[model samples]
Target: MDTAGLEILGEEECLRLLADVPVGRIVYIDRALPAIQPVNFVVHGQSVVIRTAARSRLAIAATGTVVAFEVDEFNDNCVRHGWSVVAVGRAGQVTDDQELASVRQRGLRPWAPGTREYYLRVDIEIISGRRLRHADAPAGP
Candidate 1:
């Protein structure tokens, strides 16, 4: 397939790109509807960790369920070129004392100013990414 000239990224490259970005969107169900919300995250082990308030929609929907997380970077100054990585996995609340301590050590504080004490972890079971090249970037074989 032509793939519309997008470059398909490998798993390692996808994870690297994910780790390079600080913010991503979490896709989950809210009130029985699909929703997306921006969040600050960190790559720990083979999972993505997110911090949020106890009662937030994400906190409520993320626990013990499957969700999708995505990150992207683009340059629009002169050309519209970017790369996006999407990760899908089962998410669960981080309740173990040791794991909690470790994630806290990562210094992943909430971007939004408020009391956010809950930590959610999503295991990166399936990950894929694609790159949109500038007009000049070669479509390498």
Candidate 2:
């Protein structure tokens, strides 16, 4: 519903916005339960690259399974200006030597301390987003 100036964002716009932000939430199963963790990510050619600690719960469980990654930008002060994007896909580790090397060059690192050497890539299977803005504000550049 486009209520109160809310609009569904197109795939292109959603992907664009996803790349603009450096952090997002990764939603996946941890011990048969739903878990979401804020993570630093980089959008690399239709995939979200994430770095986590090796053998960590998320790095182990989320791999080879369906997961959802979400990113959003909002200005609380501006009551009606914000956007959020979610990408649901299969998460996998970047084990390929060449691929891993390329991703390492992209600089996707964890914000928290410690050695988070595990690298995961979540393919963008189903992507969607919504944007809320003042009615008077125009859409698109």
Candidate 3:
């Protein structure tokens, strides 16, 4: 798509958008190749927290491994506008009992059926986003 009608979102706006959504995709490297997985997450300060099975791929992600987490919303109507937010960061397992308890209080539950007992946290270092709208559409409030 063209960038003519795209608006670059600020960090605060990106975080707001991230917190507004419950599901996002995490892009990581697996076996020398890029792999992306859909995960339900919650925003914890500047980090994104996700719960997965102990043996799941996300739970096995190495500490300090760079990854990208993205969330987006699109309109399928005639207007056809959408916005996407992406956060790049390092992924690590949450091992601290105190922190884990705090995250649990936030109710970051997984929608998938499984024994999701492992918690992974992505420390956001970089965040960027864009909104695409029709050329003639009115500016968003």
In the range 15-76, model 3's lDDT, one tens digit per residue, is 99999987899999887888899988989989999888878766676356999999998765
lDDT of 2 at 61: 90
- lDDT at 69, model 3: 95
Ranking by TM-score: 1, 3, 2
> Which tens-of-lDDT digit does each residue in 1-141 have in candidate 2?
466456888999999999988789999998889999999888888899999988888898999999999999877566567789999999999999998999999877678899988899999999999987777544533
State in Å the error of residue 140, model 1. Answer: 14
Report lDDT per candidate: 0.89, 0.88, 0.85
Question: Clash pairs of candidate 2?
Answer: none
TM-score: which is higher, 1 or 3?
A: 1
- Cα displacement (angstroms), candidate 1, residue 29, comes to 1.3
